[model samples]
Target: MTESILVVEDEVRIARLLQIELECEGYRVSIAGSGHQGLELYQEQQPDLLLLDVMLPGFSGIELLRRIRAGDADTPVLLLTAKSSVEDKVSGLDLGANDYITKPFQIEELLARVRAALRLASGRKKVETDSWLRADDLELNEATREVMRAGRTIELTPREFDLLVFLLKNKRQVLNREQIMTAVWGYDYYGDTNVVDVYIRYVRKKLTQDNQEELIHTVRGIGYVLKDSL
Candidate 1:
């Protein structure tokens, strides 16, 4: 089936250009000239991908992205913004936009980003996940974010759960602090790397509540790795 793309831009010329180009590429295109309409159509249509402009008549693109993520976590959204500030890009990525392109972008670049976002959404792996993570008698259901060691339930914050998943997903591979920060916290961050260490400590403390075998292994001079064998 042909991919569907929703173009949400207040500028008539830009919207039409995008629609025409995307259609030429054999995609089904939908246009929404205002943010409100775009969001309304999104909830109803649930297109494969969105080419969303930052400035809109009623609602801004940032607001639309937040609303979309709040409702649906899997939909891939590529933001089109006029601002080139690092802050703007970081905010968009942090809010769950799959990617961003500044205004006055090349048609080829725009098309490439569109294709990449669509591919990511389509090719995402749906893990046959159980209710929780289990290592021996310890368990943590991913669905409920409940952690239990030796039949005793352990509560964890959202960030701690995210950290645990990241480590688990990359089991046996040493991931640097920068990589953890980028993957878990989103990009455009230049702050201290201590945050990654802090979250790792939090997860470790929770996992070791019952003095269970440690699944997270520290590399001393390198980084963190998650594995049962190590």
Candidate 2:
């Protein structure tokens, strides 16, 4: 079946361009000019993925993301904005956005990101068939995309979950930032490597919320490692 994508961008030109490009890439695409329309289309179409632009007239992209995450946490959301600050990226990621792309972005890069998000989403569905990755007391169920530490559920964003899963799959091995980024974010990712650190911090913060012993360790001047013991 062809995957459906919902694009919520206020700019008419950008929206049409994206819709045309995505459709040309064999995806079923829907465009919304406002956040209100986006939300309605979201509820009605339930697209496989969402490409959302910030700075909408009625409601901002961040607000729409928050609302979407409140009810649907599994669908991948990619945020498009001109705000390239670390703060904005962190805020969007923290609010459960699957990926972020700065405006004036190359069409090739945008298409790559959209493909990566959809690929990840597809893998998530396939993994729901009893696949589990474990490290120490932390357990990640690929099938359900659930994480648990010491038998307690731990919430994680899609990126965070992917990062943790990558670590677990390569447990006890030091993974450099480049490797982690390429593995988790896709090979065509053009973002800075600091994104790896940011996501690692997010996963660590959530996993250690109950004062649990850290399973992920910084290798210092090298990379990071996840092991049963330091």
Candidate 3:
């Protein structure tokens, strides 16, 4: 099946260029001129991947990403912006963006990143066919991408889900930031290792909600470990 891609860019020329390039690569592509239109098309099309620009009319791309993640965290979102500061990158990634590319980027690099995101999504779907991972009272059904803790459902973003699974698979073993990043986000990821700490916090927050016991323990000066009894 040809993967569908949605380009949510406020710039007309850039949007058209992206659409043409993606279509030439055998992907079904759609373009939106503003954040509102992007959101509407996103719901209607349910594209396999989203190419979102940060600056936009009405709501910003970051805001759109937040809203998308609130309800659907499985889709891959790649952010495009002129802001190349470390803070900007961290902000987007923290909001559940799968990847970030600044303006004045090479088309080759953009295509490569897009391919990487889609490939990761494909790999995840393949792994989700018939597998279950568990740690303590937390159970994750990869097939359904559903997580349950103490008989209650727990929602998580794709990255968070991947991180938890990695930790669960290595239960009782301390995994450093580099190890976790490679296993969960792939070796090609070129972001700050602190992203690992951020995601760990996210997982811990969701898992320990409502005064539940914590299964993830931070190892001082090392990394983290998941154990039934910490």
For model 1, residues 80-127, the per-residue Cα lDDT tens digits are 887665676788899998999987889999999888887776665233
Clashing pairs in 1: 131-141, 132-140, 132-141, 133-140
lDDT for 63 in candidate 3 is: 88
Name the lDDT of candidate 2: 0.90
User: What TM-score, over all chains together, does every model reach?
Assistant: 0.56, 0.57, 0.59
TM-score of 1: 0.56
lDDT order, best first, reads 3, 2, 1
Off by over 4 Å in 3: 83-85, 132-230
In model 2, what lDDT does residue 57 have? Answer: 74
Q: Model 2: how far is 123 from its true place, Å?
A: 0.8
State which candidate has the highest TM-score.
3
Per-candidate clashes come to: 4, 1, 0
Model 2, TM vs. native: 0.57
RMSD of each candidate? 11.4, 14.0, 12.9
- Candidate 2, residue 160: CA error in Å? 28
